[model samples]
Every structure is written in C-alpha cells, then in structure tokens.
Target: MKRDRSGHFLMAQNARVLYVPTTKVASSTARLLLAEANGTYRPERLRWTDAPNISVDQGIHNLEVSGLQYFEFLPETQRDHILKSSNWWRVGLLRDPYARLYSVWENRVLLRAPSPWLKNFQHKCSEVLIDGRLDYAASFRKFVNVLRAEPEIFGDDPHFKSQRTHLGGDQVAFTHLFRVDKPGELDIFATQLGQRVGMKIEPRRLNEGLGLKHLDVMDAQTASVVEQIYEDDFDAYGFERVSFPSISPIALASVGETKAINYARDVTARLVQLSQLARYRQRSRYLLAQILRNSGLRRHKKHR
Candidate 1:
C-alpha cells in the first residue's frame, strides 16, 4: 500500500496512539500533540529557520529524528493489535479537498516551498516554473492542468498527493476521525486525546498559508477541474462541493503581490539550500568525531 511506503502513519506505542497524519490538515499540530504525549517532544527541535518546507518543529516528520515510531516498522503482531485492538486510539484528520488543493498551490507554487520532490513537479509541469519565476495564477492553473492529466505519475509527494491514498484505504479503521472544516470536531478530538494521554492537548494552527480564500481564485472551470481531480477525496471524506465565487476568470495576483511572492521564493530557495548543506556538514563532523574516538579507544586497548 502507498501508506506503508509514505510513512504518514505514526505510532506512539507508550500511549497506544496510532496517528495518521495527512499533509495540510493540521498535521504538524497533530504531530506536536502526539510527540508531547509520547514524552518525546524535543525542545531543541523547535528552531528558527527559513527552510520553506521544514516545519517550525523541525524534523518532526522524520521517524528517527522526531523520536516517533513508524507504524510500518512495528512488529507484525503489534501491527495486528493496533488494527484490531479497541484499546489503541487510531486517529485520522481530514480537510475539504478544494481548500487543501489551494493551500498546496499557495505554499508550494506561489510561495515556492522547497522540498526534495519539488524537482519532479518542476521537471514534469514546466509551466508552473515560468522562465525561472513563479507566477501565482499561471502556476496554479498549470498545477491544476497537471492534476487533471496524470497526477499519479509525479504527485507522490505527500503534500499534494491524494488524502485517500494517505489513509491507506479501508484497512485503517480509525477510532477517531476529525474534519478540520467541521465545527468543534478538532476540539472533541483534543479532549479525547487529552484523556487518553493524561495531558492537556490543544491543536494549534501551525503553518498558515497565504491569506487568500480558495473561492477568491476559483472560477467555475477551475472549480470543476478541481472537483474532478479530488472527487475521490470528496466521496471518501464526506466533503461537500463548495460554491465558487461569481467571478469568471478570477483576478490574477496583483503585480506587487507577484513581485513580492517571487522575491520570497528566491530567498527561501537559497536559505533551504544553505540549511541542507549545513546539515550535511554537521553530519560529516559527527562521523569524523566518532571515528577519532573509536581509533583512540582501540589504541588504548592495544596498549593495555
């Protein structure tokens, strides 16, 4: 299954919490709450950086770095227990499909969010990357076109992939499912999770996208295309088709808006590249230290 390889399902074995985190769905907040419950939320992980794609609580998505366990890495017996046991709290979150797609466009295309898999999109849908620049409306339209054609071929990145695929299909019987759009749904989930984990858990709004409503940019044609693309999401998650604004061919991002957005994208791309290089150097230093320490130990043992 895609979920097995995607590593979206995280397990807090100590608390018996199985969390399936879908991107752009309050997933970062969910991870924080679960990490706190697991007694593994590292304060040091919270760092200020301009790495566009890295969350504020950095490396929380990484199973090794986040101090969280992957569901797939668990033993078969334990996996069976999580799936079948009533004691385990299996939780999943959902979002409106249209809103989710807009969020992806704003962050990834408009804001030029950096990711390892972003190159795939750039290579395949070259229109999104226009003349070494990102034009907001043009990028979004091109992205929708790519989605309409063959999203499966290159949309493996969790941020833009189908939420249904992230859920691992019918086999994942979630004990608690919350919709981000529905009133009081997340609050109810917080209460249930707090009781289970023996701590107050609040779902905060982390990672806010650009301040623009999806309906603002969504014309009838774009809405129709998006609905078709995410039809499965609408059906599976019970998301009603939202009404689009009356504007035909929604106004493009203003010239000032476009300029500022492209500038931010350029800065972010550079910062992310620097961040990755810094991390690589840090790892090299650690490895060198380890080698020196081990060599010194071996020499001492030989002398003894």
Candidate 2:
C-alpha cells in the first residue's frame, strides 16, 4: 500500500531500519526491539501487507518490483521529503544456516509438517537417523540440485548475485549485520542502532524464540543429513564446522517461553491491523461497486 507523503517521510526518517529477517535468526527479538524503539513498528505489515489506503491493483504491481523500488514508491515530492529528513539507517541480523534450517524443520514438526525436503519425512518417523552421514561435498551437491530446480522454495532468484543480495536487494546499504553465533556482536549492533535512532537500547533476550525443544532430537547421521541439506547457507553465512551446542533442558524451556510470548505480542498486533485494513477495503469496494452499477442502470434508462 502506498503511504501518504508525510507518512512515507516519517517512515524513511524515523524507521529506516529494514530488517531482512531470514526465518529463525532472532527476528522476533529484533522486531520487538524495533517496536519498542518506535511505537508504530510493523515488520509484517511492511514486508507482507500493503498500506490500507493504497489500491490493491497498484499495490500488487509495487510488490512485483525489486526491494529497492519498493522503499521509494512515493511520488517525487514524497521522495524529496524523505531525503531531507534526518535519522535514516538500515540494519539486519543473520543466523547460522544449518542451525536455522534445523529450527525450520523443528517448527514444521510442531505444525505437523516436518521435513519439507523429502515430503515423506513426516510419515517416516518423528526423529531422524544421522549415523551414516553423507559427506559435506555430496550434501552440497544435493542442495545445489534442489535450489536449481525450485528457486522459490529456497528463496533464490536468477537475478540476484548472492543470497544476501536476493534477500535485501543490491542497493540497500546496511549499517549493521550481526551473526547469531556471536551473541556479543548484538550489543555492538544495538549501540549503533541506538546512535542512529538517538536512543539507548539495552540488548536483552537476544536469542528469543530459539530453543532446543524446537530442535529435532536427531542422531549424528540425521544431523549430517540436515547439515548437507543446508551447506550453501552455511558457506554463505560463514558458519563454522562445529558440533551443535548442547542446550540444557531448563535453558531450552526459558528460550521457548521467551519466543512464545514475544511472537504472540508481535503477531497479534500485526494481525489486528491487517484485519482492520481488510475490512475497510472490503467495505470501500462494496460501496464503489454499488455506485458503478447504479450509474450504469441510469445511463441505460436514459438511452431507452
């Protein structure tokens, strides 16, 4: 949806942070922080939904364009307004690909759709066997094949040069990019984000929504299978070839609670706004249809 000139400028100036949330990379926690910083933060609405005032026909075309154009969709007057505004910056976080893929699998399992890869993993078994692990090279080969066949499923494109480019467009200049493995890096990132926004943001609950419970308790062989499946992401994101961390049961529970609470809060707010907008659009369309039909009938009567 196209925002008004004033709204667009305000967003560009006050909310320049464009978080390219890649699945399970503490995206919830990052969104929560952004929400607290700006009371009007709507990550889902920005990425998924258009503005309520904007026309659906125009909005669909805007969505089809690349990310760079999407951010500056306002008229020339609005674009100038945003350019003059202060406090504009972009930032995002990344996670270990292998771990993120595992988390994805775990979430799907909870939703009763485990192993989106093989399609039959759900019917096969709740747990995966990982003893007779495939070699990294072989795993990489399979991953490449899948990506080549189904770019949409893997979230890749022919135009994008790299995975990051595919995610955040070529021109988006990020002010900060933190890796999940180095939790401490988040603090530095927060400091920079605070500087840009002109406020101090104490980083807490860094790895919110990520927990061991979500992780499928798999054998070494199964772990290798998943690792192979996500080799490209690993290489792209700079994941070290280290054994997965053993998260204690208590710690896992804490993580789960944090994730649930944060997700509930963020998702609820977004859904409410989306529902209201949808209702408004439906009502507006109904009124327009009625007016158009009456106008047509009036014209026909006059001709007769």
TM-score of each: 0.81, 0.49
Q: Which lDDT values do the candidates have, in the order given?
A: 0.73, 0.45
**Highest TM-score against the true fold, candidate:** 1
Which candidate should be chosen as best, given lDDT against the real structure? 1
Evaluated against the true structure, the overall lDDT of model 1 is 0.73
Pairs of residues clashing in candidate 1: none
> What lDDT tens digits, residue by residue, belong to model 1 across residues 1-304?
4445426578887788898888888887788778777888775644532233445554565554456788887788988999989999888899888788889877775666776676656554543334444445555666787778877744456787778878878878888888887888877877777888789988776777777767656766778888898778888887888676556543355556667876887888787888888788878987887887788843333654
Q: Mark the regions of model 1 whose C-alpha exceeds 4 Å error after superposition.
A: 1-6, 46-55, 62-66, 120-139, 150-155, 245-256, 283-304
Off by over 4 Å in 2: 1-12, 42-88, 112-173, 203-218, 244-304
Q: How many residue pairs clash in each candidate?
A: 0, 7
